[model samples]
Target: MTNQNILAVDDATDRPRISVIGTGYLGATHAAAMAEMGFDVVGVDQDPRKVEALSAGRVPFFEPGLPELIEKHVATGRLRFTTDIAEATAVSDVHFICVGTPQQATSFAANLSYVEDATAAVAKNLTHPGLIVGKSTVPVGTAARLRLLVARHVPAGVGVELIWNPEFLREGKAVDDTLSPDRIVLGGASPAAEATMRELYALPIAAGAPVITCDLPTAELVKVSANAFLATKISFINAIAEVCEAAGADVSVLADALGHDVRIGRQFLNAGLGFGGGCLPKDIRALMHRSKELGAHQAAGLMQQVDEINMAQRQSVIDKTVVAAGGSVLNKRIGVLGVAFKPFTDDVRDSPALNVAAALHLRGAQVTVHDPEANGTARANFPTLSYASNPLDAAIGASALLVLTEWPELVDVSPESLGEIVENRVVIDARNCLDPERWAAAGWRVVSLGKETVVPAPAVRVAALV
Candidate 1:
């Protein structure tokens, strides 16, 4: 009754009530950000434990600035979490579906069951007409299907209008990306739905983010296309690294020179273990699966190559080690630095570095691994592998060291110092993370992915000979 008074009296100051379904990284952030924007946000997820945790102002995962945002919003009573879909639908004027579309267990296809179920719940619970927007990365035609899904259900007086507003949030920077996005893409079945979205996103648009409107398919494609392009760029450079290795050139310099071209500006073009994480690998596979279902099998075939190239980077590193170790890791002591798929993220889904380290272990190398935040996850995934606290600890007593994930600490590690730790002087820069000249000057051997190795400097070479 008291709540009715504030909204009933001041429509001008009223932000539209919004419900965000799902409480994964994306939903949690979205719900919090909406609350930060002065909207009352009800976050819904089937995971009652997650709902409880979030309702108590706890973030399940680490993102740089998310915990503060969640705390601020939850303290204000503007954000809440629940497993109850009906209550959320009744209380909110808009619904956002932000469920995870994980890759299917046995196929390249995405298991869209979570997304479809969320949509159905929204449709069933609606007793008043409201706009239900999808903030999930879904297949192109999924928006149309969801619209039909919603229209078929809900109360007689209620109608569900579908809107597609695909989230382009990067994992580590999701909060910033959501509130201050570079651009916003909104698409739907009707002009009215698009207009409603425009109104909803007006805050960010007014703050200078471009809001682009297109068809539902285009919005969906925007997310997958961006990931695909990034994955392709990484694989492209990694492929170039393979060529550079054969030709005796440095991929770092090559990437630098080629990046000078405006069309191919330097971004995700680092020649390393290629791309891996929750998003890129899964989305690309899902897109390929969808493309085949759409009868565009030929068009989707290159993704196989893309994936093959990416996977091959891991094997290539192991092979390089095999080459360095004289064709066998039978008694090699290999230290691996960094295990996250990428740095600054705790997520280890499809982490290439971890995979490489495990493979090396399985092939008989004594693999020691280290990562700032991903160590626990890596250990959980591969308990047999040894973990060290830092770079020096990982390198100490090792026959060879490999820089797998490019953590900032590894970038600044003094090779001269590392030379003192390893039993053998060999170091492999799997992420092309080391300075060859620095290592060469430090009396240690260095190898970079997609590039040739640098032999030990004069004094170290003489010592090895002696």
Candidate 2:
């Protein structure tokens, strides 16, 4: 069937009305972007609090530029939030499932119950011909299973087609990524669905975003595979970082030289606290779990090692902090900077920086943490640890300061000023973001990963002439 027949709507422009299910990070961004593209968008979620917040032009989480965009659309009346699935299905022509498929509590495999529930809800609530788009990252073959589930749930004689259009959003740049993605992937899209999607994404396509159309399984694999490859690249450099430290070489310099090679781009080559957040860690583990299930043993093992190396970097940071704190952190004042996983967003899920701080606190250190945008979120995650609003406050009376996340605010702090307040002028640059010379010149000892520690030379005592 042609998209015109499937997407019958009252608007004179005939644009497909959009309903994004599950208004977390992915869904909220997508719904707002669709509205920006001149499509009336409704975001559906079971959480009344989330709906109310979005309706009031307030975002529940921190993502750069998302709040302003949401506020603009909300004011223009092109976007809205609702908790009623039936109302959304009745009004919208395209339903996008952007729910979370987080790692299972007991296993590494993805917990797909949310995706299943969202799909079933959309399928059962259909009042007219509509298209279902899957934007959540899932295990391969999940699309086919969901297709069957949709078929069983939708009312008879209703035309409902499902497609997978995986989302690749960085936490900090989610707004820009959604509005102008690097590429668009459409999986298992029938000609009708593809046509509708092409029209729906007319803006990005016009602005030169490449689109790839493929079968369902390939589309499902694309998201996880991309995440896995990025995670592998990070782990690869971090593995080399261990070697760099042992060989008395610098990994940051090594990574710079390696990045000069076009084949190995320098994007994820930073050998620091490795990678953490909502996506990379869980996605890699889920990929490994799925690979093993599919009997791809070698692939699974590689991912296992990648995960191990990434996690090991966290312990490396904690160990370095202990050494910087005079062999132990017991009752020592440890100041931590940057808690959000990578920075620019207030998401602390599995944040390496926060992890290190919590570990230090557990070891009897008095921990004070700070972040540009994530202090509140970090406090929620690790409440027992003390939090400071600014970097200097975190450094007050600290025995050792650790820069975990590479936020510019933390990286660009004046070492001389920090020196005056810190009890012991020891700083561990776990992210390799701080300048060792600057800190050392300011009478501070700088310990960085993948490099030798830099310490200020002791002053010689002058003998009085008799």
Candidate 3:
């Protein structure tokens, strides 16, 4: 659909009209969820390809339940995608800035250019009184600064309010999170703006999600703080995983015991290749940079180590892979399963699994990689590595296999079937998701990150089975 065909505001309903700027993962999900919440929603983006795909009821990337929901809303005329910012502002009373804040190429600071531009565009095109909500992850004080920027550009005598409403979305489970968020936060909202937001979020609010109101800085800090804490939890367990290897103890059992404590939950305690994705890695670094800028030295130091330990996990996997290959990985046919950061999504930004695969490829390993959903995205990111259609295809004629992401398919593969294909029976369980005994019984040697590999059985036994 052309910009001219975009839906105009429908004032028949008492609910506040809505517009979402920057239709990336966060924006698209928000727009669709808003539509599902019974609001007339317009999703705006500068990329025509994204707009066209979304308008055609197709999501550009993989997100569970998003494409079907977007298609449902589009068919009902409650949702539309557009490239024109002015049209979006002309049609909605509440505009959400959902742009990306990626880490800068040279610095730990986040790149706020897109957020600033989206704020400016929405502010400049306001033909009526409206609220501009920031749903992007950004440094504290960004909303206050954008408030002044919005004030300067808004039409004379036309009211515009800026508030920070940070989003907390897990990539694969975005639909459920958006529809029934754990909590809803609104920062620096005027009574009127808060009421409008309440009206906009009536569905999720009715679904038992608590709403938290705070000052702009606290609201901004909430998102990055949560990410930093989770990253710390992940790195904490991974750090223990290294010690587990040294002491020949099982990190998983230790994690389970620790998780029994009332305070320390089981979530994010998995000992594996450390956390990496579009959010955790960058958000923690951005938080650290901002903390240091504000003279908060301790937080800055803690986050720095969290980042260091997380990156070290990748090298740990590479070293283990080399050892699993019987010393040097040079000229060895290595199979890698699951390259996405985690499972059930195609996002590969700063993925630890992909990082390990690429690092091994650079070290002269003939790497073959597979992922149920991320093969296309991963291939684009690392073109030199071979892509396979399935797990068996990836493992064929391989000397060693590595399970990176905890995709269920890769975790539940038939050991006997896989053992039939590989030249050697060595398997690196980087995610520690496999049944070691089952693989060992199938005559495959299991090399996990933290757990000690059992002594190899008689060569005659391994050869006779497979």
User: Taking the tens digit of each residue's C-alpha lDDT, what string does model 3 give over 1-466?
Assistant: 0112122234534567899998999999999999998989999999999999999999999999999999999999999999999999987888999999999999999999999999999888987777889999999989878888887787776677888899999999999999999999999887777877888888889989999999999999999999999999999999998899999999889999999998998989998899999999999999999999999999999999999999999999899888888898899999999999999899999999999999999999999999999999999999999999999999998989999999998999998999899989998898889999888888988888778885346666445665
lDDT string, candidate 1, 4-112, tens digits: 1212212545556899999888999899888887788999988888888888888777677888998888899999888899999888878999999999999988888
Better of 1 and 3 by TM-score: 3
Alpha-carbon shift of residue 351 in model 1 (angstroms):
0.9
**Candidate of highest lDDT:** 2
User: Which candidate, 2 or 3, has the higher TM-score?
Assistant: 2
- Whole-model lDDT, model 3: 0.91
Better of 1 and 3 by lDDT: 3
Residue pairs clashing, model 3: none
Q: Please give the CA lDDT of all the candidate structures.
A: 0.83, 0.92, 0.91
How high is each candidate's TM-score?
Answer: 0.92, 0.97, 0.96
Backbone clash count for every predicted candidate, in the order shown = 1, 0, 0
Which model scores highest in TM-score?
Answer: 2
User: Which stretches in model 2 have alpha-carbon errors above 4 Å?
Assistant: 1-5, 10-13, 457-466
Sequence-dependent TM-score of model 3: 0.96
lDDT of 2 at 267: 88
